[model samples]
Target: MDDERSAVFRFLRTEIFPGGEMPGKHDVLEYSEAGGFSVEEIELLRPHYIRTVDTWAENLRANRERAIAIQSDEVYDRYLRYLTGCAQLFRKGISNVGRFALVK
Candidate 1:
């Protein structure tokens, strides 16, 4: 997903850039920018998502038995692995997720 998102960003950069190092023009910016959020608010996002993902991992862990019961063991394990991979990425700061609003 991140790779695909990066490819989209690359496409946008080509369309938006005039010639130099930056975009030609813009009315808004990424969430970390002043137009989208304050520094403190941006700082809060990481820990908030960490806690959120932790809760999700806990719920998935607690429901493991039911998961396996409803599905095959392989499917259940795969789901758990997927959750763990996501948690690890966020926990390690290797990835992030956010809402991108491009307003007219």
Candidate 2:
């Protein structure tokens, strides 16, 4: 499941993000400045992006919990490895979005 999560992000980056022109152009400009957006499109995409993020977050939370719940030490350690791999993907995604939250 940990590898699965990384695969999801990889798919999002390589496949879904570049699969269309909208997200491509949206990346460079403030979303508001990107033209051809009706109020309705903006409204729809709001929930869309929110829901997508929610799904991603939930998957990460569940996988982390699943890893911690394994009883055997050996199995637990394996899950911890998976957890680290998942963390790397999350960190990469946050960086990709230019969301450096700790700026002083």
Candidate 3:
């Protein structure tokens, strides 16, 4: 995992998803078990998310003028920064996304 104090992390925490935190797989498993659920499966989706973010960044760039016109230069730049940063983080494995199945 990347340092939480990293510029990208700080920007994301403060601007994009306030109060959001990513928990480790073990943390999720333990929490679920404590709540009387069994972990059925966990599927990592980091690669998919990287692709998704990359596509978003591309689309944002393509529609840069429209985005800025519809929103604001600040908003357009912020989202572009967020999407590109997320894609890089996912590519480097510093961030992860997942799908989980639980049985109660």
Q: TM-score for model 1?
A: 0.51
Question: How far is each candidate from the true structure, as Cα RMSD in Å?
Answer: 10.6, 12.0, 1.9
Per-residue lDDT over 1-104 for candidate 1, one digit per residue giving the tens place of the 0 to 100 score: 67844643454345334253422112224433655543332122555677776787689789988878898778776656555655665676655654343433
Cα lDDT tens digits, model 3, 1-104, are 44643888889878998999767788998899999999889999998999999999999999999999999999999999999989888888888988889999
Clashes of 3: 0
Ranked by lDDT, the better of candidates 1 and 3 is 3
Q: What TM-score against the true fold does each predicted structure earn?
A: 0.51, 0.24, 0.88
Tell me the deviation in Å of residue 40 in model 3: 0.3
Error of 3 at 93 (Å): 1.2
State the weakest 10-residue window (summed lDDT) of model 2: 95-104
The segments of candidate 1 whose C-alpha lies over 4 angstroms from its true place after superposition are: 1-45
- Model-by-model lDDT, in order? 0.55, 0.45, 0.89
lDDT for 51 in candidate 2 is 46
What digit string (tens of lDDT, one per residue) describes model 2 on residues 33-97?
A: 45533232321233244445556556655665565565555555543444454445444443222
